[model samples]
Target: MEQLNNTFVAVQAASRQLALLNSKQINNILVAVADAIMEQSLFLLAENEKDLTRMDKADPKFDRLMLTEERLKGIATDMRNVAELPSPLGKVLKENIRPNGIRLKKISVPFGVIGIIYEARPNVSFDVFSLCLKSGNACVLKGGSDADFSNRAIISVIHSVLKKFDTDPHIVELLPADRQATSELLHAVGYVDLIIPRGSSNLINFVRQNASIPVIETGAGICHTYFDEYGDTTKGAAIINNAKTRRVSVCNALDCLIIDEKRLNDLPLLCEKLKKNNVIIYADAKAYRALQSSYPAELLHPATTESFGTEFLSYAMAVKTIKSMDAALEHIQTYGSKHSECIITEDKSRAELFTKVVDAACVYTNVSTAFTDGAQFGLGAEIGISTQKLHARGPMGLEEITSYKWIIEGDGQIRK
Candidate 1:
């Protein structure tokens, strides 16, 4: 908790002086951070490996945060791309002329200090710093204890880069990885501006309920992709296959597949593709019966009600063969986490309609549901996939990390 206090103090100093720093200084720091990222890539990978090894025997949620060498290179690349993005702060959003002798301007500015409490993804150390710097905000990062050492190494690299410019290194600060310490800092709403809890549903819910600060809850990707009766069979199979099997452990992966009843006959082909990838198929009663008659009995079974809300996070999916689009929407509304959804179809009208009706951050027409990422959206790098309905909705980037303020510069214009 004391660590967060020191972080807050440093961030406050930076936030106060942000308006004085020109775009060149910010850009220079970004370039330097990228340089440092590339230089320290080897050390980051080694540190990550140590954490990854510990993840092997650890619990499920803890293990998911462990990273590898390839992932480390990707992180470095992500930072480089992020450094190349446009500055989000100090932008002229709007200027208004009032009836009186007053000119009001609503310009983009930085949120004072962002406090992020996230799980195993240690790369979030860079993500928060990159976005905060680009957005002209300061950040206090609290990583999960499971990857404390890894987080330390990553955070140190960021601070080291800041040191070159002789800037306050603690502008991108790391909170102590103690569970109780996290609560203590979270409750200090006066210290931090906003809280973004990016982890499990239970963890986020607790933070939202208990924290004094406002929270941006993200990471519950019990996402769904529907295959309408008028959908293209090939595209349906391909999209669902990619969404489920591409990287099963990630949040954007598809959890359920809704196939139209008229298209149930084609289930054999879809099931075959999934089976080849060793995906466990949980079929609703209709799909179970239909699949049993066409394919082997082992390929069919009645799905439980809880299966609809289940997030496999592995090479597995639960399929519900619906009769209409209304059923699809009904099921989704009941079980969907409102992260990302897809409608695999060639019909322009239906696809457009589905995109409009679906209440998700990203609604895809025929693309794979897995493409709901920051890089895919051309945002350089993503801090996290935010499911919250606030300032940020999807892949949180530099632009999303910022908040605007109405800066009124007046020359002693007193109220008459």
Candidate 2:
């Protein structure tokens, strides 16, 4: 508790100063941070490998945890891109002239200190810092224990860049990777402005349930892709393969497949593509019976009730056969995590209806669900893919990280 208090105190003391940084100053620091990251790639990779070697290669998080030269370059590119973007602060969203001779302006501003509790992905340390800095907010990062070494190295690089600019490094502080400190951080309502959890469903739910600070939940992705009766089997197969197998460990990877009952015979095309990549299918009884004759027994298994909503962060997906588009929609509403959902259909009206009716952060038509990302959306980087719709939804970019302040100018008027 004392440790967390000290960290929060440092951030609270520095938050105002951070918010005062002009766009040019913030951009310059971010550019320097990007250069520093690229320059120190050897050191960063060495530190990352240390953490990677301790974990099993078969683990899904390994892909997210390991940072290669290409990924490092990509990270550097993201930082530069963030620097080039327009500043989020000081944008006047609304201006009003009141009858009492008062001018009211609602301007965007930082959220002070944002506390983020995430797991495994060390790149988030840099991504969050860049977004927070670009938006003029201080951040207190609490990374999972697995990436301790990598995160330490990354933060060291970031702080060094901050020091070079004569800015207080406390603006991007990292909390101790322990449960006790995390507990204190969760309840530090006065110090932390908002909390965002960006990892497993269990972690997100834990923070949502326990935190005294306001939270924007980034729920786990039990994403789904439905193939309508009129959809092209070949194109649907390609979309499903890319969405499901492109990067299975990530949040946007497809977890469930919904096929029209009329197109049940075309299942082999999709199953063949999945089997080519060695993906195992956990199918509902209807889907299982339909697929049993063609797909190998090892590749097909009966899905239990528990499989419907599960986020299998692996090369595995749950399959279901639906009678109609409505049935598919109902099944998704019941089981989806509201993260990302897609529809593969040739009929324009059906695709439009699916997009309109499906309540998700990202709804797709004739496309893969894997494109649900901040960087992919050209927002540079993201805090996380928010599932809830209060403050921010979808990929939380710079604007999403900001809040508005109403500035009222009056000579001698008061609220009557």
Candidate 3:
């Protein structure tokens, strides 16, 4: 057991050493990974189809978690973008010369080896590897068991690319496919610099409770969109429609809507647009009557405060009417998961103030909540949208996996 533990520790130490590489080398590895992702697109799609053969396209769980042609194309485009972004590591953080001839500098560095445990989406396998490598962090991935074949295939292709990049192919690795391997991985928490959990709340919460290693909690976008009194009904209608309807199962899609009490009358027009996009609305008592009279019961669902935290991940939404901005914010604080929130308001003061106050990873003004993505933020690719407030707050791109260390160069300087 002692010798085995030593091997585990070495894996982590090696991963960290590789993460300290210079910017140019890191960029070269990312470029190679991106090229590999594009090259293996067809193989990836075929493997995903095998997985999908067991799943239903219309199934919400399958829909939220499957790989498709468009998604693969999107992934390819994103990896190219990640390859284009400037390498984030090795930037001199600070430089100061001491009177005693000591030059101290803090520099951006990789977090060594990152342990990523995610669920059901195979495309993420490529994205996570790309981001971690670009930021000079080696990663150990454990994807959802449902995607076992796809995960292994993607990792193999990535490793092939790494050989040509002149980097340690082991920089990116995968965890054992066996279910028992997770317990072993968690116990080796000392072997990983940071652990990132991306999946359902149950999975993320499970890792948080069991792992002693540092973990970045993510996923659970029971987010919201507030329509102020001055909301452009046209814009509000369009934005919310696009958000809830465009991709119902994504993390940043709108789950709730808060309309100003003064503008409660707009609910009719709003519901009209939302329903046209095939959205099912869950409304409060006040919004219920307006919706109840305007639409059939099939188009609405009755929800209490408890429903506020629901991330339906379907063509469904919850609508609320509050008296003030404070009231709206309070509701979100009460039930939100701090993922993403947006406000549609013509008033700049209200928009700015709301943006300042909302405690979320991604907050938006007068736009769709679903725009909270790494690509939308123009970073090329995203590993995940982190819900954790520490270390990283929003999209975990190639730049988010690194840490910094103080580098001190002294000429015979001694501590007094």
Highest TM-score scorer: 2
The top-ranked prediction according to lDDT is 2
Task: Give the clashing pairs for model 2.
Answer: none
Computed on alpha carbons, the lDDT of every model, listed in order, comes to 0.79, 0.92, 0.80
Q: Write the per-residue lDDT of candidate 1 for residues 75-129, one digit (tens) a residue.
A: 7777677777777877889997776657778877777788889888787787778
Instruction: Please give the lDDT score for candidate 2.
Output: 0.92
List, residue by residue over 260-338, the lDDT tens digit for candidate 3. Answer: 9888788888767776666788899888877787866787878776668888878888999899999988988987898
Candidate with the larger lDDT of 1 and 2: 2
Worst lDDT run of 10 residues, candidate 1, spans: 56-65
Give me the overall lDDT of model 3.
0.80
Pairs of residues clashing in candidate 1: none
The RMSD of every model to the true structure, in order and in angstroms, is 2.3, 1.4, 2.5
TM-score of each: 0.93, 0.97, 0.92
Candidate 3 or 1, higher lDDT: 3
Give the per-residue lDDT of model 2 (tens digit) for 224-336: 99999999988898999999999999999999999998988888877778887788899987888888898888888899888899898899999999999999999999999
